[model samples]
Target: MKIKAIAAAFAATVLTPFAMAEDQSDWALVIHGGAGVIERGQMTAEREAEYRAAMHAALDRGEAVLEAGGSALDAIEAVIHGMEDDPLFNAGRGAVFTAAGRNELDASIMDGATLNAGAVAGVTQVRHPISLARAVMERSRHVMLQGEGAETFAIEQGIEMVPPAWFFTERRWASMTRSLERLGLDLPERPEGAPELQGVDHGTLERDEREHRFGTVGVVALDSDGNIAAGTSTGGTTAKRWGRVGDSPILGAGTYASNASCGVSATGTGEYFIRLTVASRICALVEFQGLNLQDASDQVIQDELTAMGGDGGIVALTPSGEIAWSYNTPGMYRARQTAGGDPVVGIYGDED
Candidate 1:
């Protein structure tokens, strides 16, 4: 009887928590800052700790929302918003420099249960691009808005607007200047005064080059109610010209969500991602092809990115509470929290 009672008690203690956790719908959340050349040696212990703290803060914000029964969309937006406001990860306040030496922000959000999406691109005045994206998704009929029009819509919707200078940073400006100088040094000099073309001084003239150094910020969340959502934000590309926009504000490219499958947020080369539909493709592969979330993410980030001649990474969470992360670069800043309260966070690729 004593042995039987001990066995029963063990079962009760172990199984009860699992049963309750399963009953709660098994919530999970994941976030990423971007993927790039991150080496373990390059990141000092202090820097790594800072990155981890930021990631945890973002996760904690989202977890609170999920615990309080907030919709997955809300949780995702809140978490991403935190990153956007921080200057560390290069989304909103810390966006990269554009060709014109300015910052142009982009963001998107999606609700998996309803397929509702919102996006804003080339936004200069909005204080929080993600908030504008949510407004576009919920208040406006359009899926995306750009430039002054998007700003106008944001103003009408009561979104906080800031000056263009609000997006500037000294590091970004210095980086842009250095990049232009380097590009000039790499170009071959033409014959001395041969056909002095109007406005064509290849060596002296500085052409705007976009900064591809930083990664976008994103969140994927599964709430207690079994709903999933994803959100993404970016500063576009550093030193980009001709109003070039990246995958961040484009649905299915940088952000995607589906109630039947999962929610995904991507950070990498924007042009390649847009062509391959990286975010949506991951969800489709998992839902339709029966691939696990990790396998699907790997296929998309590795196979798909290679096929498209692009590289980057993604963070995802499925409705069944599985976490998926994949990156082809040397590193991607990411974090996760399981329904069981375990937390994992890292910046370098092998930091696990």
Candidate 2:
């Protein structure tokens, strides 16, 4: 009897912690600021700390909702709202200026449970384009609204609107100026007249591409109810012309989710992502080929996109609380938190 009782107590002791851990949470969340050529040499410790804090704050926003039994869509959207308000990332306030010396923002959100999505492109007046995207998903019959029409829909929905100048920051303005100078063009005086975006010469796109760098913000989440969602937001490419829009506002390119597959949110060169359908392709691999989330993402980012010389990455999550990511560039600004794990944020390849 003594030996039996001792064995039972041992079993209880081993199982108690596991039970507690399992009960702590069943949800997971991941986010990415952007991915491309980030190096330790480029950032000071203080700046890296700030990026870490910003990512943690965004994670907290989503984790709080998931822990409180909210849906995946609600949690991911809330996290993106935090990112859009911060100037350190390129989504809303910090969006890059176009060749026309204006800011055009794009955003999209998807619900995995229903595969329903909404997006907005070339919207200059909306304060938080993600929320406007949600409003489109829930309120409108259309899947996407673009340009001035998107703005009109946003205003009619009573969403908070901001002036176009509200998106301008000194940093972005400087970037615009630098881009123009690289192409041997003069910077246009903002608020005075439109920029001379026409006939800017050819070798400029490669130069402008190097100057603008890359940035977009994205999130993927798994809720307590086993539902999933994904979202992405961005200021279009720097010095872009003719109302150029990126993958951020495209449902399958920047964001995709499916309860049967996985939720994927990508950050990279928007043009490449658009051509590849990066997000949905990852989900499709999971759903059709029966690969796990990590394997599917790895195959896509490492094999397919890499073959095309694309540089980018994705933060992907499965409904069962699995987290996975892949990037071909030097690094990817990424973070992830699971049911019983603390948050982990990384800016470089080695950090993960």
Candidate 3:
């Protein structure tokens, strides 16, 4: 081809028109349901459609907040609350059962403007743990509260409380049983009045099984005011033992935000995330190393995590509204919306 023809081809790709949402809006947002072995071949059409719809709803909800001139922290809080209400992903209503046959939730939130953050862990009463996390950040001096103490603070703050049974769902219960069986955990005897349980195959653990034990839901957003924020919540690993609290509530592990660099929310095996300080590490890469948002996110999720025998993903946003995400797994439930385009949501590796 002639030089002019090649130049024209490149221009065409660069100058393609997009469906803009607002004229003066200068904001962006992205959310993730989780990252695991979510392959298209293994998902039924109905299931895929369900996930896509949920992701779109989350993106739109958060984008609406930003378009209305809401704070980036508000957008992330609202987006994460909606996912926690939906029983589809393991965060709020769909949290997995622990080895003790009960629900224990963990959540965290961050404000990039002042490095303010709050976290709550092993709280079973709060319907929206993210809100409790924000309360801890804004209402108190502490960065984290755990178990009954967190619940007490939430109750004191007049946060809406739910019964433990409210989070019980058939899907999460089944996943818990399967994980227990794989780990050879002996269950209590089936009583005469109890229903007979059916055996289920939860699928393969694959390489890095220890680090890919479960999934989490999270969000990162940038507002018109140039502030960034991030939040994360999780039901935790299925059949998790000994009151274990994953990185979801850890400020520098599964969630971090910084106006000086970027905001990040992580999902996957929480232990590995904590060990490597994944979320803060990305921000450090951007702030200290002068890497762009995309480069830092890719360096952490794609290269570092994978090399460490961990599998997961993250969504990140810079102060300038640049967005990026990376994952080594087959799929990550993710979506993004900005002023210049409509929402884009995907689940499988091919979609990425």
Candidate 4:
């Protein structure tokens, strides 16, 4: 009888690990385009459908990577690359213009397992700033690079560079001109070969105001190996002046990830996000405050950020495979998908 009891105990021990592994999450991903004053009646049906399609495309790219056993870092990079190329969301090609009529981009990426991160700012000629940010994290001992120095580094790494004109779009140019006029600031010269503007439609401009007020693109992912990663890319703000830099390239402010905590990527008013260290704060809440990813996101964005008059939102993923996002704005372009699951998307605050 004693021998039989010992054998049963050993069997239980052997099966325990397998049970835990079965319960563990395989992989998960989340993404966000910008967030602000978006409301139901503000956007035309055609425009809203386009945004939904774009979100789905970004999700497909990231889902493919995670499903293929790729690292969390790789999954997020793939997602951001698609958005940066899509003219619908402001990041790379669709970046909003600064007061000086130049498109100065910024981006950052983080590795949760290693706590390694990289960032770049004011990169005018690089075609894909997110790639440059990763190169900074991998190639150099530095965490951040900027402006002329960043462009030089891109050249050394053989990343694609395009003329500043490549970033120009008629809608962005018109937005900048209107903003400058509102602030009584002088307009800068148009980019070479820019199309002549008759007049931007008032409805179109209003829709864009809500959508692009805090324009940025970001992604966070948890992979099959239980690692997490987060990244963000942006063009600062429209009509920004004097070499302004937003939170997008600041590690803890705009982007943060940790295997022990959660990965976070934020889009909103840069100054407010920077002041609160929004991304890191959200993770800290989950790690130390004993809150889940969803509640932690709410505390920072819906409660604290809103109290401070800040507007924006964030996408987050925990090591255990929880995906969450919270925005004080009326709408934010976002989506999520888990391994072997169909993509789920949300735009308005009412979505689950």
lDDT of each: 0.78, 0.79, 0.81, 0.86
Task: Identify the runs in model 4 with alpha carbons over 4 angstroms from their true place.
Answer: 1-22, 196-199
By the TM-score metric, which is better: model 1 or model 3? 3
RMSD of candidate 1 to the truth, in angstroms, is: 9.1
| Residue-level lDDT tens digits of model 4 in 197-286 | 667787798679767898799999988888999999998899999999999999999999999999999999999999999999999998
User: Against the true structure, what is every candidate's RMSD?
Assistant: 9.1, 7.7, 5.6, 7.6
Residues 118-137, candidate 1, lDDT per residue (tens digit)? 99999987888999999999
Which candidate number has the best TM-score?
4
User: How high a TM-score does candidate 1 get?
Assistant: 0.85
| lDDT over C-alpha atoms for residue 236 of model 2 | 75
Q: If the candidates were sorted by their TM-score against the true structure, best first, what order would they fall in?
A: 4, 3, 2, 1
lDDT of 2: 0.79
Best by lDDT: 4
TM-score of each: 0.85, 0.87, 0.87, 0.92
Clashing pairs in 2: none
What's the C-alpha lDDT at position 168 in model 3? 73
Model 2 alpha-carbon miss at residue 250, Å:
1.0
Superposition error at 116 for model 4 (Å): 0.3
lDDT of 3 by residue, 279-332 (tens): 999999999999877778888888888889987889887776667888887878
Model 4: how far is 99 from its true place, Å? 0.4
